[model samples]
Target: MGATPEEGAAESAAALDEVAESLVSLWSLAHNAPDVPVPATQLRVLFILEHGPVNVSNLAAEMGALVSSASRLCDRLEAAGLLLRDHGRDRREVTVRLSTDGQALLDRLKVRRRDDLARVLDTMSSPARAALIWGLAQFRDAAKADKGPGSAGESFSLPA
Candidate 1:
């Protein structure tokens, strides 16, 4: 007899909490390193937009934020020239995209983040780096399972 299902779930949850904390800490550190003029929330919005233009409601859902709060964040980002709101073909729907300045800022940030990560990875052994990648992939796959069907992992063929 092995551990009960409840015990397994508890262990999984604990692991997830650790991973989440680590992600948040790393993201906070990297995001704040440049001291960009935009607020963190606005930068988050821009990050989402980099994937593609999206409606306010959908973006809010993805960000796990209230629609109103997302709207306010969008307003601030737009005012800061980081985002642009365009009328959809339906006219009733509005789509948000990163503006030219926003793209430029994102590009700069991406380069800086890549440089930082490269520096860190350089200090890690190849096996250690591989293990870290594998662990993160597993974590991402487990998170997608919790999100139900058709999440990001479903689109790719993962090793068994």
Candidate 2:
């Protein structure tokens, strides 16, 4: 008899875990190249800012880190001219945004990442690539759906 759907899903979950680990290794390799050698934590901060400006408190919450830690990271980025901080609606609220240099850096990093991924995908069968695209979209939707009130994503935090 064929395996039940639930059993198949469990197997897929296990496979996804391995895939996630491989992706992290690939990301580290692609991200830590000669020109784009930002540390992963700081890279995460930049990635967050790429989405839009965020205040220190909100950034800390997103990273599941302390405000002081996030602020320190911001300080470094500011010193490096990688980010800009401006007053928010009130003087007390400091909003952080990626500077032009930061955006350029991220653009370079993303291009490298895409090139690396393309090399690998180039070797995969077309059908397999299609399946991966479809499956990843489903996974993304499910992950998003699972992101509230102590769901599995609650444990998802940036590597310290």
Candidate 3:
């Protein structure tokens, strides 16, 4: 008999945690690769805006932050010319949009990060690369299936 399922889950969770940390490091490196480095939090706001324009209140809800804090974040990004802030139909409503510069920054980071990851993958054996791809697909599926807490109906797909 080998380790129990609970033990196996524990081991897997620990490994996943380590991988998450490494990914976060890579993410930070990518964020800083640009000439104008955007703080992680501000980069996050840009990512959120990428989906579409969002009002401050809704953005605050999504960020799990106070509306004032979210507004302040928007102010910094706007000042950096990474995003645009405009009022909704009602003067009381404020909407945020990612500017061309912000989108370009995101595009550059995506290329850099993918290139860095590809370099690492090239160092790995072919079998390992295949395994990593398959494992990531499974992880995406699992995340989609998990409807527990923090589930926001978001789904992700791996590039072909």
After TM-score superposition, what is the CA distance of residue 94 in candidate 2 from its true location, in Å?
0.4
Error of 1 at 12 (Å): 6.8
The residue pairs found clashing in candidate 1 are none
Local error of candidate 2 at 1, Å?
3.8
Cα error, residue 37 of model 1, in Å, equals 1.7
Once superposed on the true structure, which residue ranges of model 2 sit more than 4 Å away at CA? 147-160
10 residues in a row with least lDDT, candidate 1: 151-160
- lDDT comparing candidate 1 with the true structure: 0.79
Model 3 spans with C-alpha error above 4 angstroms = 149-160
By lDDT, the candidates rank as 2, 3, 1
RMSD of each: 5.0, 3.3, 2.8
lDDT (Cα, tens digit) per residue for candidate 1, span 1-160: 8889999989988987887786556545656874687868888789889878999998898777999999899899899888999988888888899999999888887777667767777988999999988987886677556545655544332311
Question: For residues 24-121, could you state the per-residue lDDT of candidate 3 as single tens digits?
Answer: 67656777764756787888888888889999999998788999999999999999999998886768998899999999988887888888788778
lDDT of each: 0.79, 0.84, 0.82
Q: Which ten residues in a row have the lowest lDDT in candidate 3?
A: 151-160
What residue pairs clash in candidate 3, if any at all? none
Model 2 Cα lDDT, one tens digit per residue, 74-117: 99999988999999776888999999999998888877777877
Clashes of each: 0, 0, 0
